[model samples]
Target chain A: MKPPLWQSIGFYILVGVIVLQALFPFYYAILTSLEDGQALFEVNYLPRALNLANYQAMLSGGVFGKQILNSVFVATVVVILSLFLAVTAAYALSRIRFRGRGLLLLTVLSVSMFPQIAVLSGLFEVIRYFGLFNSLWSLVFSYMIFTLPFTVWVLTTFMRNLPIEIEEAAIMDGASSFTIIRRVFLPLMWPAMVTTGLLAFIHAWNEFLFALTFLSTDSQRTVPVAIALISGRSEFEIPWGNIMAASVIVTLPLVALVLVFQRKIVSGLTAGAVKG
Target chain B: MSKTVQKSRLSRSRTRSAWLFLAPMLLTLAIVAAWPLGRTIWFSFTDASLDLMGEARFVGFRNYLEYVAWGDGEGQYYGLLADARWWRSVWNTILFAVVSVSFETVFGLIIALVLNQQFRGRGLVRAAVLIPWAIPTIVSAKMWAWMLHDQFGIINDMLQTIGLIAEPIAWTASPDTAMVAVLMVDIWKTTPFMALLILAGLQMVPGDIYEAAKLDGVPPWRVFRKITLPLIMPAVLVAVVFRALDALRVFDIVYVLTPNTDATRTMSVFARENLFDYDKFAYGSAASTLLFLVIALITITFIMATRMDLEGKRS
Candidate 1:
């Protein structure tokens, strides 16, 4: 049952539109990044010149390079800490049947949905009390509020689906719960960990509010905040070229990771949302 | 009797270890989430300034609402309740959430249906759809801001070339078009997430039903309306609520794209402004408290409405 020629053509056109709409903005950003001075002022959709001056300027000037490193450090520490805590907690939540377990899971899930602004005043006080203001550690500490719950939820969902027979066999051999988790579940949980860790890393990398409020210094700012605060010397001359170049540099890694782990990302997202 | 005792001992040890495993996470949540949230609420009841938070005095409901009477028991009201801008921000947040989520759902469904088709380069198309979602929100906001630039923007250039308008519009600066520009960027970024969620739902629908409908000569539109839509409604509804809750707290895009515009100032922005910029820390805490209450009310209502199983037994 072949479709009619017109219908097939219409379908292909729809596909073309979807692909174009999805990819056009990033393409335009990349194009705009390569142009400088008069080239930027003129709107040319096509690639005209291959210039790396904007990238060079952004990397070599100001605190932009340090900001990129700040984002990397914050996101990396956040992912590692959240994954370690979430795995142990997920093992308990998924494997053990205890009283108030359902309520506990619900509490964790609700915490993730908290509006960041809601905690701003208090978290600010906490940061000041701990003397973490104007430091990257403030971001690492605050990001856990959003990252921890989803990691636990997704990993709990993933851990529950593992085979129970292996655990039962391990139990018969008189192995402790820690040993079973270490020897039995650790190897099998790598894919789930990777998926959740990547999502956590992305969340921490892209977080703007805490980064904006907690870190007042120019060098301590993350990439998102730094990009938002990027400005030229004069109000009239906004540095769009350097901004786009920095934007492209930070986004390329995330785009590559998403493309490569497309399947795992999809599964991880669905596991968190659709399953709930 | 010996077997029963052994079982009891094993179960006791399991429960103990479970608590041990959960202790670290629960403590972290208490320190980061629960304690901070409690202090935020507490600050709302006091006159805490940003610089002199320690010397703050308690003021019951003054930050939320206060009345000063000078003559004949008649005067103006002061506080968040009386401020028209606060109400406006609440309205803006709701409107942004409702409008953006609705557009994302519709566009998401269409893209999901298109991608669900058997095509030659389906993987490539799917990967392309993920691009917008993969880009950071602030980066996308900057990219769109550049493209929507009033003077040298490509959007204005293309619109002129297409004869859509006579004069170039200042998208982010102008009050009339600020919200529109924000919505455009938001829809572009979030539609992929909605589509992916719906795509997951679409995949769950068995193919045999579609085959059966095809054998019966059912029209494609009817098949979609009658079969496909109903089956995926649960997933779509869940996604909608999720996205709505997310949209209610929208800060990054609105902050980056249209700053200091009354037309697009969300509750989050308004709260943050008072917290730091306006030097009204207690008042800002009050605003933050209300925002949390709104989201919490919506979430509770949603959970009760759906009767979502907290325990993983049913699924």
Candidate 2:
């Protein structure tokens, strides 16, 4: 039976409210970022003036450039390092009949669940001991604790789904194991590789506590920490226009990536969490 | 004899290949992940201080004993039972997880349902809603913090314009509203992710069943309750469980959005404060151990409940 007209209206209104609620912050931020100097505090519903000073100032901040670089460097390194090991490791767990495959996965899964806070104190000592604290490399190394397990787990999930006969065929061609993985299997598994890579990339980029704790100076800061801690010269104020501009600038890339690869991103992120 | 020799050689090579492939990952895990985890657990039982790391002493079961209350002298020895902060942190952590996850699941399901329909500009809308999820948690939290400021925020302006409130509220500063404010920011940032996951699950269900139900003169609500719910139940449950686990580990959003007030601090935040700010390395490790156990227990329960056969469920 068709619902009454009022019910339809109610449903539409409810959904409209939801979409509006979801979109409101972005709209508000964009509106504020566009306004002329000090106009953000005067008007709240919409922009009163059109200007780009906030964006310019945000880009000009001494912290902004280095923080962006740190985030990019850390996320990129973690992706390369984790994926390099994950691919080979996943092949072993999926293809080879190993004695300790189960134990290894179990260990990874257990380690993955460990709250970073639990490991922070000890990792602090370790990081300082290695003289790597306040360095971007420490953040890269710490992020493996976040990404490596999932890379192996999900890639292993993906690899096991690949046809065993293909590998058998490669073996018949006198291909070395490393050669087979590098040439034959890798090309086929690229999508899954990218899927896991994107997840790992985002995790590293979004990491905050380690970056906040491990880095003290603006030169070493990541974007998230820099964005979180930026204060005005005085206690009575916050820099709203610039903060909004910074958030929008940082978020655009991620939003674009997610929108482009919605299916892969969805599957990659939820894969481990779902089957936990 | 040549054939048999080749076979033996192939088997020997196979063993070598397997070991070679396993070597890099195993070594990394052993050094990077495994040893650190072991070291953390060990450090938890010892009276270790961050600054005074050289003066560590082994105190087996003392950390565990702290939380274990009984008629015995465990309270005096462990001190966890004596300290109300630990218990409060646990309660606060559970509350944050439960409340935020529940809200996210409901809101996500609604959003997923909306996106599942065939309509114009659907792609644009779906992508747009995910903007918050794409932003780093720190950025999103800061963005929301500005939007919720007491005096000059758009939220208060809109609320006042709509006559929803009598006065502006100190969202992050007040203990009364701080947790709720944090939860709101978290919900905003994570709901789209939940929606996307649920949407993925929604798309997997066969539409023919609903079409057939319609031919049978089934009402919309009945079709949804009978056909859609049962079919999508497993995926939805999985998504919800995943979300719950994620929420339980929420630290960044809370830590960034609000001051470390007692009411707003999740267990992870509390543990971090203990470790870094207070120099209580053992205590922080203890808190982390408990948090790990909580997450592990949830994971185990989910696995058992779902009865997942990952090898079989290739899709």
Candidate 3:
């Protein structure tokens, strides 16, 4: 039997509220980014004006442009390194029968749970020892604390689900484990790769604590830190308009990825959680 | 050569290759994670300053004792324990985790239930819900801060216009409402995550079970309570554990939106302040170590309780 009219209406209302809650702040950010100086402080819910001054001001001067580039480069490098390491390790963990494999996987998971503050002091010493303080490499190295474990876990789950016959056939042809992984399994793993890579990229991109702690120079900071430390000329004023604009600029790419790869991302997320 | 000899050689080569494949990742993890974690524990016992030139000396458990002890009849506590702000932060962190995770789980269940229905534009709705999760935490914090601004924030304006309040309230500034404000932003940001995870669990409940329940004229709520909930409990537990761990260490949202205010300082913000801002390096290390231990204890307990397989197989 059909549900009553009020129940249907309630369901739709709930859906609408969820949509609004998810999108309103972001929608408002875009609107705020578009408003000029005087209009910036207005409490209007809708877009009041079309202005590019904040965006222009943010991009033109300061290290905002370089910071964006640094964020991109850092996240990209982390993804590549994480995926490479995760792939080889995932192959070994899933395919090879080995002792202590269970313990190894648990150790990897535990590493991901280490709070950045827990490692902050020691990592500071490590960075300084490597002469990477206040540099882009510091963020890259430290982010592995999070990104690597997640990638390995998700990729191992994906690898285990592949058919055994394929690997058996490859082995029958005298394919080494590496050769089988490269020629046989890698072809079937692109979707998993994309999902894992995108998640890693987002994690590295959104990471704030380490970025805040590791990089001190204005130009070397990533997007999150740069936006957090974005300020007005004097000590008294904070340039909210410029900060919103920078926030929008940094967030847009990730939003695009989420929208385009929504299905894969959901699967990737569930694969990581439900399986664990 | 005998067949067993060849088999052993092949198996040995596979083991060697497995180690080879794992070497780089393990080594990277060692240098980046293990070494620093060990050093952090060591530093917790020493008075190592953030300043590179400061003299380092072993202080034993003085730092840890100060973190948990009261002072000698002087109307004060010693160490981080003595600092009212530190206790406030610890309380705030626990409060934030319990309240925010509870909200996320409830709202997420609602959204997941709604999305689990057969509907048009379900895919689009799923993608739209991810927007909040997709936004960077700093950006989300900034966005909410602007919208929650007492003077010109849309939230205050809308609340007043709707006759919800008589006057504007300073959300992040005041001790009374600061934690509430942080919870609102966190729930908004993470509810989608909770929903998606629950939705995944919901999808795993086979349709035939629902059909069977319908055939027996079982009420929807009954079906949900008896069938859906039990089936989804594992996923829910996993989601809760992950979210709790994340929320317990929350630093960016509180730091960006409210700064150093005691109203919203978390353990992380508290510890980071000691480490970097106050130069109480050993003290901060102890605090950090304590935080790690709390989280590690929770994680270990959860793993052992659930008997979860790392292989992700259904066993």
Candidate 4:
């Protein structure tokens, strides 16, 4: 059942267009980053040079180096905290028969759907109250508002599918529920944990509004904010090449994660979303 | 008797641990999400400004009046209701959401359909499209901004080369094309998300149904309309609702690409300005509360519709 020749050609052309639309921006960014100074002003489809000076300059100068470190530290802490809380709660909801579990899970899902702006002012108050303003801990605290619900939901879905016999066997051996979860269940839940953790990491990595609001100083800014506020020394200058360089550097890890764990990422997304 | 006693102990401890396990997470959420949300609602009723945080006196309906409408008679209205910029932002948000979500759905369906077919290099193409989704929104906005630069942007160059425009257009700078520029970036970044969701939906359709339709010698479009569309409608609806909700609160792309422009300011951006820049905390809270209500209404409607659809399917 091959398509007609013309239709096949058309299909390929459409596919080509989709791919180009998806990749062109980043591709163009790379091309721009490679061109320094006067080369950036020209509209070139292909790379005219392969210069690493912008990347070198971004890393060597200013606080971008610290910003990348802050992003990593914050994102890592978020993933750890979110996975820890979500796993325990997911266990309670999934394995232990409990009243109001369904309603509770639905509530958790709805919390993730909250628009960030809706919580901004109050969150600002909360951050100020905790004395966490301009600190990485503020991001760690604020990101949970989003990361927890999603991890909890996805992990609950995963835990619900595991066989009951293992837990029962552990119980027959007089093992505690906590013991069973730590020793037996955690071993089986690695794939789910990995998928959920990675998704949480990516969410924390890409979050902009919260990052932008909570942190003010150059030393406290995350990679996204750093890239956003990347400006030239002069008021009129934008320094496009340096911005593109920083963008590529920040995006490489995310692209690698997506490529390597493509299937797991997709499953985690559908599991978290479709179940809603 | 011993077995039953052991089982009882296990059940009791399990309940205890369950509560124990849920406590920290629930407390964290209460402090982080629920409490802040409650405070936002409370703040909406006051005249709190950032400069005088603790001095906020309860001014019943004052903030609301100023946010919505507060003026003497003689056809005078002040507040957001009187503010043309606020209305323009609201319009821009709705327009952006509706148009972008509609296009994303159509393109997502087409992309999903294409990707659903068994073909060579499918995996490569799938991975390629995900690049946009993986990049940060700010990064993508910056990238698109460069590409849409009036004087030196490649997009303008290509358009000019192709004779689509007689001159290089200042896309983000011009009010007429600002919304269009934002939509292009949003649609580009988000269509992959819609496609992935719709692809998941497409995978759920049983092959036998399609086989039966084909056996009847149904035209392809008829098969698609009758079988594919109906079966995938729920997933598509879910994707649409999600995208629409997201679009309604869109801040990053718009804020990054077309900052300070009335033509592209969204509800979120409008609220943020009052809260942060203008130091009108209570006014911002009112705007935020309104935004929250709008999102909540849409979500409730979606949930009700989904529930009814499920019950209808059951019947």
lDDT per residue as tens, model 3, A1-276:
898999989888888988888899999999999987778878778788989999999999968999999999999999999998999999999988889898999999889888889988888889998999999999889888898999999899888887778798777677888888899888988999999899999989999999999888898889999999887779437788888899999998999999889998888888778887
Sort order, lDDT high to low: 1, 3, 4, 2
Tens-digit lDDT string for candidate 1 (B1-315): 999999889888899999999999999998889999999999999999999988888999999999989789789899999999999999999999999999999999999999899989999899999989989999999999999999989999999999999999999999999999999999999999999999999999999999999999999999999999999999999999999999999999999999999999999999999999999999999999999999999999988898877788886
**How far out, in Å, is residue B102 in model 2?**
0.9
Candidate 3 C-alpha error for residue B23, in Å: 0.6
Best first by TM-score, ranked: 1, 3, 4, 2
What digit string (tens of lDDT, one per residue) describes model 3 on residues B150-256?
88889999889889999999898887888898999999999888998999999988999999999999999999899999999888989999999999999999999
Off by over 4 Å in 4: A233-236, B1-9, B66-76, B308-315
**What value of lDDT does candidate 2 attain over all alpha carbons?**
0.80
Q: How many residue pairs in model 3 have overlapping backbones?
A: 0
Model 3 chain B weakest 10-residue run by lDDT: B68-77
Question: Order of all candidates by DockQ, from best down to worst?
Answer: 1, 3, 4, 2
Model 2 quality (TM-score)? 0.92
TM-score for all models, in order of appearance: 0.99, 0.92, 0.96, 0.95
Q: Model-by-model lDDT, in order?
A: 0.94, 0.80, 0.89, 0.88
lDDT of 2 by residue, B171-272 (tens): 988889998999899888889888887877788888898789878898888888987878877777877777777777778988878867878888888788
Docking class of 1: high
* Residue A250, model 2: Cα distance from true site in angstroms: 1.4
Q: Candidate 2, B47: how far from true, in Å?
A: 2.3
Q: Flag the better candidate by TM-score, 1 or 4.
A: 1
